[model samples]
Target: MVAGDRILMHLQGRSALVVGGTSGVGEATAERLVAEGCTVVITGRDVVKGRAAAQRIGAVFCRADVRDVDAMIAAVDTAADLGAMGVLVHCAGVGHAARTIGRDCAYSSAHSLDDFRETIDINLVGTFNAVRLAASAIARTDPDELGQRGAIVLTSSLAAMVGQTGQAAYAASKAGQLGLLLPLARDLSSKGIRVNAVVPGGMDTAIYGPEGPSEALRRAVSDAAIFPKRMGRPAEFASLVVELLRNDYINASAVELAAGTVQLPR
Candidate 1:
């Protein structure tokens, strides 16, 4: 490989599949990958959003929910068909606000067991489902000079480390991603695939959808930020992901993209 090609712009001629690519961080990452000359396939359950994002970023759209085993496998297949499945960025996740223990009321009551399980199922299990299926396909690819077959970027949240009042399920789910990283990386080492997780703090994303945070809650979250005094940008998250993919040395670690925010205890 040429000197420049070895270091910078390693994503050129690569192939990537981004789950949850219909919006937010996934969409931004897909766009960045496309700009880097990577063939990209994006998957999401929202067909309209997925197709729009795919068209916007010059990528193919596969409607797959991360929780669906067969559907996720198919999405991986769609990406692997492009080339070797060089990168799998899993940005699909869901979050809700419910305290584990609270006052006796419908909405204010303690977190339900069913809610916790659903969160775990969608966020943690869903992530692993995609990772396992994608890693299998990626493992089949011929390794590069460095014996690197591919890289996997899993999305975690800062709440995994320090959670807020109502973040029991979300934090547990995201923390599970971090927990899986080391073992998954070690297990896939023989296959020349690298696994890493990104822990992001508050970000300007539609993960909350229309019923997002109230003005008071938003201020509280933003005020906790240390430097720059604002929530993270999706592009910023994407840039870090691209960097991790280019640098083969970064593996099995959870990189925090929190901007030094020290969240106050609830």
Candidate 2:
């Protein structure tokens, strides 16, 4: 059976807000949430893709960048208005492809500070923005019989732990997610909120578009895996997110879904 078909109705009567749910893992997770009988809201900067994805999943589309505090609050409110807010999956982020130093003749072309800042703003800071606002709204609601009010799943990357060349900024931003997982879980535990992170390995997503990585690079990466010798499917990532939501005992953990692939110098 497909990933959507396998989802348990654990999310019935609850609501989920997927920040960056327009495509890839985010879109897959949104679809799974809907399959599990949750009212879902998805947010993204791309109106065309966001609306289309939401329509496909029968979810509400909120056009908001995760970096904007007011916009994130509004997105959270949209989900809460649907039902008791219980799930938040943050998947809005960008990839950094530029190297810390350019390979030009003079070697004067270094990665701009602005570029580094932008990566952190969108990936790290934006995630924190969504988490804080969403958790606040969730905390106001009463916990379930299991004493759990909400679950948050943040997307980290394998780069956070073992990044390849040209991934300094990307890896740092993802590592910042790891930094947030434990503390946020502890801080929100008193309110019956659970926070966790997923460090996904190379996945075949829009993040690496048709023009992104070469076929050889992709194959070599797949060959390095311990098993499941291929790029991960978005559904695989989504399945884990759903499991984390229903299993309350899985708080403050950073789960890796890379099939044991390791990073080598590019």
After TM-score superposition, what is the CA distance of residue 110 in candidate 2 from its true location, in Å?
0.9
List candidate 1 segments past 4 Å from native. Answer: 1-9, 105-109, 211-214
**Clash tally, candidates in order:** 0, 0
Give the per-residue lDDT digits (tens) of candidate 1, residues 1-266: 65435743257888899999888999999999999889999999989988998999899999998888989988999988887678999999998778777776566576889999999999999999999999899888888876778899999999999988888899899989999999999999998888888899888877866665466666776788888777789999999999888887788989999878887776
Query: What range of 10 consecutive residues in model 1 has the weakest lDDT sum?
Result: 1-10
- Looking at model 1, residue 224 earns an lDDT score of 88
Q: Estimate each model's TM-score.
A: 0.93, 0.93
Residue by residue across 39-147, what tens digits does model 2's lDDT show?
9999999899889999898999999998888888889999999999989999999998778877783456888889999999999999999999999988988876656
Q: List the residue pairs that clash in candidate 1.
A: none
Top lDDT model = 2
